[model samples]
Target: MLGLRFIGQGFAGLFGLIGLFPVMAQAADSRLQRMETSDAGRGWEAVGRLDVDGEGFCTGALIAPDLVLTAAHCLYDARSGVRIQPKTIEFLAGWRNGRASAYRTVTRAVVHPDYIFDGEVSTDRVRRDIALLQLQRPIRNTTVIPFQTDNRPRKGADVGVVSYAHDRSEAPSIQELCSVMARQEGVLIMSCDVDFGSSGAPVFSFSGGKPRIVSVVSAKAEVDGKRVSLGADLAKELQILRAQLTSTRIGSRMPEGVGRVQVGGARSSGGAKFVRPGG
Candidate 1:
């Protein structure tokens, strides 16, 4: 798999995690509000961390189960700065070190052959920012967001992008939101603030009375600004992902370490980890 490095260096300050808040606490348009807050309006659960080598490592929702989508750029050779084969790495869902009940290793990755990271096509950055991972087994406990496969949102639609960015701050909690500014040249550009840790966040739309994922956060505008964009119209890539997910058999339960465990919350079945609002 090949792709661009999302946001590159210096993205930390620019993205600020504060930018992750939705433009409006709630959309004013009754129709849009209803769609965005509906049951179907959930976003993807993406886990990304800065690895020991200082590169972004990520894995996230590709479908209901059996697949984890991410940036292929994360799988490069630490020494040579070259693309690494998809087989050399692993994907852990609900990942937490030392927690046996919070992780799962991946079995395969499908990378787009045309992915490039040299910044040559800065104008059209959406082409290769996506990839898919097939888990060795299926995950069944987490909620999965539905994707919109056909038409994307028109320019200026109020959209939301969510990820477990850097560490949680006072802003952008579990389901942070943002608004879409434009969908140009294959990318869905938005003003939702995202930072280094949010590389693979899902970009979603409130359409036809329901929320649906239309794109995945790929990278940001030149770090000179706070907003970012996602790769939309990867229906071909999504088709590949959906096929893998549907073919795999659903497992009886979430593998140990393969689902979210709220960080500061009581260890109940599947509660969220709470962080003091100002902590």
Candidate 2:
């Protein structure tokens, strides 16, 4: 997170550490439904609470039997920019009312190489705010199926999200109909309801009657007086992160891609977009 407040120029709220921002452009009928029981959490078993060092937490989703996807900042010390040890992190899959469908320890982790923990809150920062965690052991539970992902949808496309928040830490919740307000520089700004601990939650698109992740919640910010969640393009960014992790295992340099610099794209002057210094 850039900080706990928006500052009218840069986004500052990172979920699980900052106060919830005022509801700005949330879908009127999309109420959070807590999955406190097995039945309620049936299809969402892969959405888990990421317990970081057992002190703080964030939301993560299993993209593979042994691979978890989440926000890069969640693995870094917000104050020191030091990366947190992978051993201390735990994935409580489908945690609800003190139980989890499966529990696993993180053995290795990888963040987008361009992700700067101490960077200012800008499009560049949010565009690369993604990470991948390899579990010590693969979770083969049938019920805890890893989610499938799709490309970023066009603006105004309907989306969904599942997450654990500071208030609803015991059980995950789902908001089924948030709207993507805009897309720019590989970032998607949504009118979804996200808060502290909601970082790294998966944004789902149910276009073909199947829930496919289209974005990963990076941070929540207010845009044009309306609260919106920020995330990178899932399909593209995930590939970059996967390549980074592959290089890590082989002790080789990462391949060049969109994770680094941004090509020319449209910039918005409205408060709804990511603003640079005095932008």
Candidate 3:
């Protein structure tokens, strides 16, 4: 239940409401297994590391050849409260050890129009904390296939996550099965193990017999002194972000306060603890 505190902090209000009962998954939950080898990392090449302006990184997944999905908060500077420049970000597909299966620079990006990056964590913010990035070119790598997304899983369903965090930034790790502890508003609280730089990591559902992304890690929360991961319910928010991306003209200027995730800088002082971008 540890969080990427360096990226941001978790909120406290919702803990009073979520059920502590362990929501079971179709498969037994397993500890995070690092995909350090090519064989261990196969089929998960689409889950790549989002290198933000070279300052830090977050976990992101490809949903289409040119489209990547992640958290909205990742588009801001955790230290300066500034929106990042899309051109400065790089999508390192299947980053393992020191190499990647594919590399692409980000051309344009968009966050949920309603997503506010004020740097505060809350159930409301987490619910809409989703964004999509457009790669400069489509990834034609045969091994790297984009994942289709589905509605968030029910409370009784099991889920999985693949991510890159500060301690294991060189490669991604996977928790094949975890419980979807509870659902409130649009946030899916789960028993997934995650840490800093894990933001924007995709939460997958395997009930359909194939993995389909159903959520994006927004923040991590603690309840009853035990930690749980929080994620965006992708169904509705992703729809809006897609439309925004479609209407966006290449090289067009986005209004300030919107988003572009860059993981740089951090507050040298205290604030509401939530996961910040670029863990």
Measured by lDDT, the strongest candidate is 3
The best candidate in terms of TM-score? 3
CA lDDT of each candidate?
0.44, 0.74, 0.79
Ranking by lDDT: 3, 2, 1
lDDT of 3 by residue, 256-276 (tens): 453333333352221112345
Candidate 3 Cα outliers beyond 4 Å, as residue runs: 1-27, 255-274, 277-279
TM-scores, one per candidate = 0.59, 0.81, 0.86
lDDT of 1 by residue, 189-268 (tens): 56665554455555656666655666666665532334345554556656765565456554421122221211333323
Per-residue lDDT of model 2, residues 1-279, tens digit only: 212234322334532232223323444639788888899889999999888655567889999999999888777655444567777789999999888999999878888878887766667788788889999999999999999989999877889899987668889999988888767678887888887678789999999999988888887766545567788988888898888777676313322221211111222211112212111
How far residue 1's Cα lies from its native spot in candidate 2, in Å, is: 24
User: All predictions: root-mean-square deviation over Cα?
Assistant: 10.8, 9.9, 4.8
Q: Whole-model lDDT for model 1 versus the true structure?
A: 0.44
